[model samples]
Target: MAISFDRAADFYDQTRALPPEVADQVTECILRLSRATPETTFFEPGIGTGRIALPLVERGYAYTGVDISEQMMDKLRQKLVGKPHQLTLINADITTLPLESGVFDVAIAAHILHLVADWRSALAEIQRVLKPQGVLIYFHHPGSGATRNDPIDQQWRTILERYSYQADFVGAVTEDVLGYFQAQNLAIETVSVAELPRIRTAAEALQTYCDRIYSNLWQIPEPIFTPAIEDLKTWVQQTYPDLNERFESSYEVTVTAASRAR
Candidate 1:
């Protein structure tokens, strides 16, 4: 169950204040990951709210972004209008985009591949769209290195399924994703040596969970989302016993890069 970034648009930035230095790390890591050349025509699929895309664009990379949410795209549109960037944006699904093939130097599906349903087709399409020797950078949010059967993770899933209005938990594993790219015959490039930051304090974690409920708990009607949210809060309180303490979050992220064989 993939969730779209909608009602979350307004508070998106507020909630996502990654440490300033993290940008440098992401940029450097991506550059190292993809070996992007000056001539690289970068593609950032799922460019939500221009968080990474904007900074990458500022670095003088030619870019194209694709996204499914109109509200998110609208915000990005506003960012691109006033800035000087060598970038283009399209409102389409990455899984089935309307675009030409062999046109770009690199295609980056940043933090988005997991949310797509037909991920294999999307990857194949990405490979098709890139010229031979071009690279594909796939980024994902893993469950912070927690094993698939981690008790905490299982508990979270159970709570969400039974209590959350919509159960939208998608996990992207680094090794498996890398294997998929390899099966396509794309030359393996790099896999980050370090894991990505996944969790935050208990309060932050709780707030994030609650926020998603506001944004993605759509299985229930409007009248029910709130009640369900309250129930979740009560459950969390009873479970944690210390609602103010920062609980660890399990949101690991991974980045893999591969190049089309010549």
Candidate 2:
């Protein structure tokens, strides 16, 4: 079963919020690949907590967001309370949303496609709402493709190896996004695919996994996970004795752009 965003909304931003720099990159990449101008009206499906919306709206873009979780939307509302802009949020599912046809200048599905069981339906809806020549963008933090040799990530992998690992947005990735774009006859373009370096303490990253902040964490059985956690903790102490020591990591972000036929 998919994890509920309402339950996850409490500390969602705390655990998984996009850094300000990353948010800016998303906005800039979308605009650079498409014909959207500063005044273009943008829509995002599954715009949880407005993480990606922040950068664009700050630049004076008109934005509309749709999501099923009232709690998630509520959190976004809190963030926007004193902020000013033309922002509208619909508390609804994307597939059945009653939004008008061909009205939006751009539509973004950042990290959202893989979660929808009926992703094709969601694609159709995105197609419906975008005007001819309108752009559709998908943003994703792809699965760790390059391989992480870091002890901590390796430890997690060892534990995960014991069982079949599957999580939310499991089957969704960049290739799926491209396939959908092609099926809909939208011209596809790769906007960005670059590695960003990051640093974090072993303890910090380990705690995030243990808390299962991401919905995928719940997919692992407790019996298997408990042992893995213990093993990881022991290994971390043996390797990085100082909990404050930071280690390097490479995070990859991918953005895909497509246009509705004019």
Winning model by TM-score: 2
lDDT of 2 at 236: 82
lDDT per residue for candidate 2 within 26-143, as digits (tens), equals: 6678778767677798999998898888777777889999998889989988877888878899987877767999999889887776667677778889878987778888876455
Candidate 2, superposed: residue stretches over 4 Å from native: 144-151, 166-168
**Residue pairs in clash, model 1:** 144-252, 198-251, 199-249, 201-247, 202-246, 202-247
Runs of candidate 1 exceeding 4 Å displacement: 1-3, 143-154, 161-176, 193-204, 213-231
TM-score of 2: 0.86
TM-scores for all candidates: the values are 0.78, 0.86
Residue 207, candidate 1: C-alpha displacement in angstroms:
3.5
> How far is each candidate from the true structure, as Cα RMSD in Å?
4.0, 2.7
Which RMSD does model 1 reach against the true structure? 4.0
